[model samples]
Target: MSTVVEILTQIRPEFDFSQSSDFFEDGMLDSFDLVTLVSELDKAYGISIDGLQIVPENFQNVAAIEALLSRNGVVP
Candidate 1:
């Protein structure tokens, strides 16, 4: 999940993603950040994340994000 952490870090370097799980609720990620993250994830993982999957739960944490990617056919 280093790649996922890398993407998150690239978006917001101030917060420590490794120590957090509430990216959305804690204000670590706003809608604009989510959009940028989605774009980066699509390019990095060759996966498309849209529609309902754009919800906060999917982007709440590293594990949740990984689960979303897996559900979208990405191995990890």
Candidate 2:
């Protein structure tokens, strides 16, 4: 699976995603970015994260994204 940072970079390489705890609050990501991220995540991890898991909390940071991926059957 691609790391959250990697996927995020593909979507928005201008920002550094690791320095912030809340991407949304920090203005690092928006709703459109989130949708693109979900698509990349599914393609990279072979795990489908449906709408239920596409909430802000689940995408706050790298840790949150990893946790979400784990819940969706990703190993790490």
Candidate 3:
């Protein structure tokens, strides 16, 4: 989603999220970023991301994030 890219860019403008597959493995995002991202995602998509859903795997890339949103009953 373009909104996903926009949110990520707002969080960390230096990196090109579209080019990265694994944000954590590639060192593109840290734990702090993850926390902030969760907050942003929750607000932007109207879905709460917490507990086990906050794992690294769910925040690894755009695809993973999309899947997480879907699991949380968010359409996209």
Candidate 4:
């Protein structure tokens, strides 16, 4: 599995996330997905993401999500 997928297995997507450049824009993810992803990310990275950091820009794609984890102090 891709790193991003590994980090978010709790909210498994039927489609391959790696194929999408922008999960939100592509309709691969939505508001409910974001909430589930955030919870999964927090658990996987052992960091609490700030409520303010939960934005579409931060979850636009795999790279963006990785960047968000880095911002939360999860070693890249």
Best by TM-score: 2
Cα deviation of 75, candidate 1, in Å: 2.3
Give the alpha carbon lDDT tens digit for every residue of 18-56 in model 3: 999999999989999999999999889877787888899
lDDT of 1 by residue, 1-76 (tens): 4489999999999988888889988888999999999999999988778787888889999999999999989976
Which has the better TM-score: candidate 2, or candidate 4? Answer: 2
Model 4: number of backbone collisions: 0
List candidate 1 stretches off by more than 4 Å.
Answer: none
* Clashing residue pairs, backbone N/CA/C < 3 A, model 4: none
Residues 22-69, model 4: lDDT tens digits: 888888788998998888777766779999999999998888998888
Model 1: worst 10 consecutive residues (lDDT sum): 1-10
lDDT of each: 0.89, 0.89, 0.89, 0.79
Give the TM-score (vs. native) of candidate 3.
Answer: 0.92
**What residue runs in model 4 are displaced by over 4 Å at the alpha carbon?**
none
Listed in order, each prediction's TM-score against the native is 0.90, 0.93, 0.92, 0.86
| Local distance difference test, candidate 4 | 0.79
